[model samples]
Target: MDDNADALDPTPTRGATRTRTALRRVPFTLGFLAVVFLLGLFTGGLWSRLDRRSWYPEIAYGWPPLTEGKFWTPVTGWVFGLTPGQYLCMAILFGASVAWAEWRLGTARTVLVCASGQLAGILVASVTVGLLAHTHLAWADRLAEVRDVGFTTAAISALAAVSATLRSPWRLRVRAALMAYVAITFLFESTFADLMHLIALAVWLPLGEKLFSRTEHGFWPRTRREVRMLAFTGLLVIAAASVAVYFFPGNSLLGPTGDERGSFWSTLLTVLVIAVVADQLRKGKRWAWWATIAYGVLHVTLTLILLGVAIGTDYATTGAVTVGTGLLWAGEVALLYGGRGAFRVPLRRKITEGALTGTEPGVAVRELLARYGGSTMSWMTTWPENKYWFPADGERYVAYQRHAGTVIALTDPVGPPDLLPDTIAAFTDRCEADGLVPCLFSTTAAVADIAGELGWRSAQIAEDTIVDLPALEFKGKAWQDIRSAINKATKEGIEFRLVELADEPFAVIAQVRAISEEWVGEKGLPEMGFTLGGVEEALDPAVRVGLAIDTKGIVHGVTSWLPVYGPGDEIRGWTLDVMRRRPDGFRPVIEFLIASSCQAFKEEGAEIVSLSGAPLARSTDTADTEPIDRLLEGLGAAMEPYYGFRSLHAFKAKFQPRHEPVFLCYRDEADLPRIGIALTKAYLPEVSAKDLIALGATGH
Candidate 1:
């Protein structure tokens, strides 16, 4: 036991040994950089006038070493104008640029990012370039992405991806800013830098670090999934780049004769670099600049082969072709593995809890998609339920789907283990031989656990909520307070008449939109009101509108409700959607709605009526819990502000409802980035980080 305990510890000192091992692996990277440096020096020559204005390209005869062909005349013709010293420095700079990332992530990890990032960047940039180039838009529109729509932009973009996926905070800010400046300097000053790198980084670090923190095996298949997504994305990128480059024209990309745009060395260089870079991506680096380089190679190779057959080549000029290919090979290789630890001296890694053991961002995406065509299992939108089996809140829809052989899905919060055992059995009996089984996206673990406890097979679908709405007994002091508030509203002439959804005073959709926008923005509140595809996402067919109108036909406040149900059960829920009262007296919309929903549901023989969760925006940024909680601690005592927690709790006090704590738990843990991305695309399509963090914390 003691030996096992000690082994599991892997103490700090033991962990430090790994760091030492990591440092030891630096030679591969150093050697690689050294080769680039010397060659750059050789080509740049020994000296020149010390002024800075003069700079030119040159060939380092041995740094990459010339190997073949008579294509030397044109290639050397451009290089002869440069001083050898200048060429060496430029090569050295490029090598150093490649080395920066290797120092941070550990050689293997760094190499992974470089290789994969390069392949991804190249392919993406190439396609984007090609698409923009070939579009029928005007020159201004075609060149809108950059002053020059060519492969150099693709190259920078590929590098940005490498840096974004692997660079640390400080390095990212500085390097990214520097990259932007250079890209702008060379391309279009007003462009958005073909920077897919930031996305790569966002996808890489958080997921990689989080997943890797788990036992290493949890990371394997997930990593494969990320690689797969990168591959698909790479192909898409190439198509976009192709359009951008070929259809656009700018002096920055024009190769002498502006007509030689797509035929330029720079464009070819960007595409060609892809093969070299993609070859280097290991770990996260494996997809490095793939599509971009592939496009370039295809274009250049075909052009050259056709040219050779048409015009013919002589052995004397072979040196030029060799130089061109060599410079390309060196840059591609150097940049391809251009990550922090790709060529680092090896150091033993430390295993500290919560410290990043590894990072595999978006690595889980494909694994999810492979199992399901999408990353999430939402309440709506799936063809499988029609093809498969799903239960809706409605029986007719369910019957129609079953009859039509369409997929239908449903969720049950909490009830008997066999809450739907009969339903599942019936479906199974109907489609037993075919393997199409009815699915239950359960709300409570107790419900799902029972299915498993009963020897029935099941899979976790989703998590939901239920409120234990007790009777509206006026026995308690708080319940009495709720009653009193309703009495006051009636006395003040605030009446509630339940109207059909279509008979509401204002346009339901437009009114909800205005209130929602205000709540999400200026109102310091948030809602899950289903802004898009209408309010039906969260509401049932029993929905009703309670408009608080005055004698003048003026709207004072508005509320909505519905009777929610379960097998052999039903309850009333008052949705306090929008409440704006005149200053003569603010109407207690909560009191009226609760009273209305209760009366309606009770008459229908429902046992209890739920006021529902306060639809206050709980998005992290808008949530005011911190200050309220702080007051509870008496931290830095002060005259309590009027509207803060002081007012919020006061309103809830009227209902005097029992507190039902809602906890947001995940499957061991949750993917925050995925959640954030998901939420932004959901409630607030324009949501920020605060939105995701808030949404991720949400529960019914």
Candidate 2:
């Protein structure tokens, strides 16, 4: 929109101010719902007639009887102060409080949070309240009044509490104390409504962070079932109103119809309908179509019967009439229409974009921003966030690309999906120190978190994967086979040497680069796990380089290894960062490099040699899932036609390496869990520390 708006992007949008951004529902739904419920009770007849001041004493002991069984006869009493009115009010308020929440948090999460907080509140209420009060609810009463199906209380609690990492070590002491307080208060008094708040915080923050943090599907606006449920409630209101007027003639409905004073019933029905409709509208539904169709049919019938009478009907006014609203309410389910916005994925595009402001621009999609500040033209040389931040020790990297403007670099996944503005700015500042082109790639969105504190292009893109050496296994049949392969390579005129940083890294790298470039030419361009920069480009202090030359001193290829079991770091998986063979002796050369890499890994005591993947190693399995077996099977099946019949598998299978399968689970894919991240090479370029961290954190 406006330039200033772009600058102020990190700030949260205030929902109550307008149509309500998904994130802004907290104040209105959480706080405003409480206010309205209280008013509804006061106005809706909780104290319909309190002329006898003595009746006021009923307030002090209300909570105890309600949670108890016998006092709530027919399961309807003991609702408010053991009155149907109170139950109706509780239902209304509770529904309102959670409807928006369910909409915001998604179905599963909203239910989980609410159910948990409700249970926590109930149990804490039971133990504490039971300890203090003599009255206890019979099993029947407990079942009816507080049936423990899902989290009604906990959902409310979660809605109230805003912290996502409730179990974070730093927040543990406080979280524990809060949980204890929730237990105590629910036991002693009915006043504490913050348990749900705490649960809300505990459950929602992480979920929200995760949902939005998904480098893929977060940030799009769309409605979910929760919204539709609220919308459907409107049609129920209309149906219920029609029935109330038809049957309860003299109760307080419209004009008297027949017999007794059923007219007052109409008044109550109208209120119910109004409450439901208002709730639905606020939940963001254009119930206009259903509302119009439904009302049109019912009104036409009513008009024919009242042809001789005078009656005024307003679409807006009639919606307030309530009748047998249950079926109508239930029918709200058919109102599932927000699919367009909810599931609409944007078409993929290059991540970098432009804004004249000094700040990094927002991305169109979460594509890995090759660590360059957006300026459409500078896409090629930009690195992803991690690479930009490779030298984590506050050193800036500068570069001057022949085509783009001055290149100053910073390292961070700085904007929207990440928001690491300050880190980005600080990183670009490094250019002054290193004297290079300044740019930043927020490997992690941390860069965007501090945007307010910096003024630079904070935004960056993500790359598929980055190769890292320093960034696992078991021996059995697999081990014996690998040993044999290594032996075979040794007999094949292959020579291996480990360079502990000082051992002439380039002498070996030059030979490897030549072979690698030649391989690149044959395989096409842009090696998946490597850059054109070669072995020297792959070296750093945290890494150890190794070279495998032929007996003639012509380095056939290169291999890197790492300490598998460091006292400080439990390193297990060793990556095959670079392996290129001379075209003339490619097969024997590959076999030698492969065997040598495994040998070096074993020498260093590595458990598994991570050969990235056959396809994209990404899969749809959670960390807790048992997928290694299935992954191995799939790899065997797919590679059978190609790599399996070729030298790649011949070499790999000889190692008898236990296949480690990876999966990718998208919120959209129905069978996502079944989708394997077949091979990292297919999905990602190379692995980086950030990818490793995300693997641990998000379990993607």
Candidate 3:
């Protein structure tokens, strides 16, 4: 009878199954919201302010209510809000935050956290107000008699606790935003609700890591990017607070305000100066960091003098605005001190630029590569964006880019293989002497091993797809796609040609540019740089270009191959770089071009054809991956929709190439954040904030 019933019902649909799972996961959140809604309806508080109601005093929690022996107010107050607007906000915020917490911590634990947080916020805030009420501070005395209702504090605490469980980037991002919100509101508004929020956040944000988190917790900024962002946000917050004081100047936690605020023109000038410093801080400028530190110290010193005078005379006329601004300045000073290492970029022209003649670095790097062959990616080191670092002997050089106070070496050093260790050591020593973090990105296993021997950590960041040309043939099921593409191209009258791009006719070059532009136009992001090249790189005479052209002389697709040098200045292989095709002209032209290029290179005695590694794309064997690896994987997933890097990686598998791992080697895991940002800057040098926001929206 059960089997007959199961057969009749069948399995639930995916959407239904997901809905059931979601409902099961957030039972406490749902129940709490439902109870609050019922209470609001019963008390007529859904459309009206509960505080104005006759029965509010009995249920509201605060110092005055607690002193009157209404201990149960803590329990009753959480379900009510002072105003109808607050009720709406409470429902939305509490539902979203608690639901997320329940999803992470489970229903039982989430209930415990929410309840504990709510009770603690109310009792702690009440005790604090009661203690400070007799201290003659106007702000405290005023708040002591105020009663508040709502569970917003619990939502904030729950979110703060969950923040400890997050990984890099998000962990830092959430904590920064939470801290900024609480700090800003408490200092400026100083309302009873604001005090509750500040108290809850202060309790949970630090202690919750021990109580709730399973991951390692450290308060320090992990990446250079985090440091710059935090510093920038701190400066901007100070600027914002100044604007608030000048424009609003309402009662605040520090004291009463209004009379002590400076002239409007002076406030505007201060804000403008802070705005400029904030932008410079975002760029990790040394001058900006020092200037901000000096400004903070000076402001705090002056405020302390004023505070001393007021305290001594018992006049108490310094105002809350000065005290609040002083606290923020002190905070900014501490933040800048903690992250001082990130702000080393000089105010003058970059030290790396034109260290030699303008073209000397690029020319010297290429000559060294020819003298002693490096990894497949070595040719990319000669790109114009790179700055070369030559040792004292000048026998070898490392091509690198300085960004975010870090020196990121590209590929392997160019020189004799025997001098690899010395080259690595020299580069490391130079970075240390220069007070820059050292990193080696997109390098081979040999370089990674050398870095590991020197106590550096290495993680696979990409896989170089290589097709061995000597044994290459299109046969069997694996080569079915390539063979079909070739046959289709033949029938379609698409001819393949290998030539120097610069040698092509003006019309042909223009078509290639148009085709490339069209492909880039579809992505809605700036063209990626770093190891990724474009038509300019293809224009090099040494770089070979393969084209798929129809009988009508229309270009269907184009591929650029960088020459991989062997010993004795011989070209042993070709590494694929730029790959672009006409969106409307060719369907399988890429496969046709790659297959034809392989055959052409094989005829020319090249040992292999490299399809090149896709950035952030990894193989299936993810065993024993580190935290940094997982972070990169998540980043890759987020970017997959916009760039299709993983899709491209998968597409290369059609050629049946063997995967060789390329690694990012660094001195410490803590540097991954800065390195990640530097890599992003290197890739999308032209990408704007608006472009990134648009990309993020598209990803969502």
**C-alpha lDDT of candidate 2 relative to the true structure:** 0.38
| Candidate 3 lDDT trough over 10 residues, lowest sum | 349-358
Better of 1 and 3 by lDDT: 3
Model 2 agreement with the true structure over 1-700: per-residue lDDT tens digits: 6998898777655654454543354443444345534643773435553223353323222234445543322122112232335445555656665665566555566556555555445445434434444332222233232321112354345435322222112122233334434433332222323333344445544554464322122211112222333344444444444444455433111222243214557656756765665454444334543453465456545544443242343222221122223223333433323221111112223323232222222231112232223211122223121122322322122212110122322222322233344344554565447644443322223333344245322221211221222222324664565455457667876677666533565666556545554444332112332111234334543345566666777776665433222222355544444455565663455555655665566666555554433332232333453454354344444433322222442355544444432222111222222222322322223223453354434322
Best by TM-score: 3
RMSD of each: 23.9, 27.7, 13.7
Q: Is candidate 1 or candidate 2 better by TM-score?
A: 1
Measured against the true structure, the TM-scores of the candidates, in listed sequence, are 0.32, 0.26, 0.58
Clashes (candidate 3)? 0
List where candidate 3 sits over 4 angstroms from the true fold.
1-22, 260-269, 308-315, 348-700
lDDT comparing candidate 1 with the true structure: 0.36
Taking the candidates one at a time, how many backbone clashes does each contain?
126, 117, 0
- Against the correct fold, how does model 2 do in TM-score? 0.26
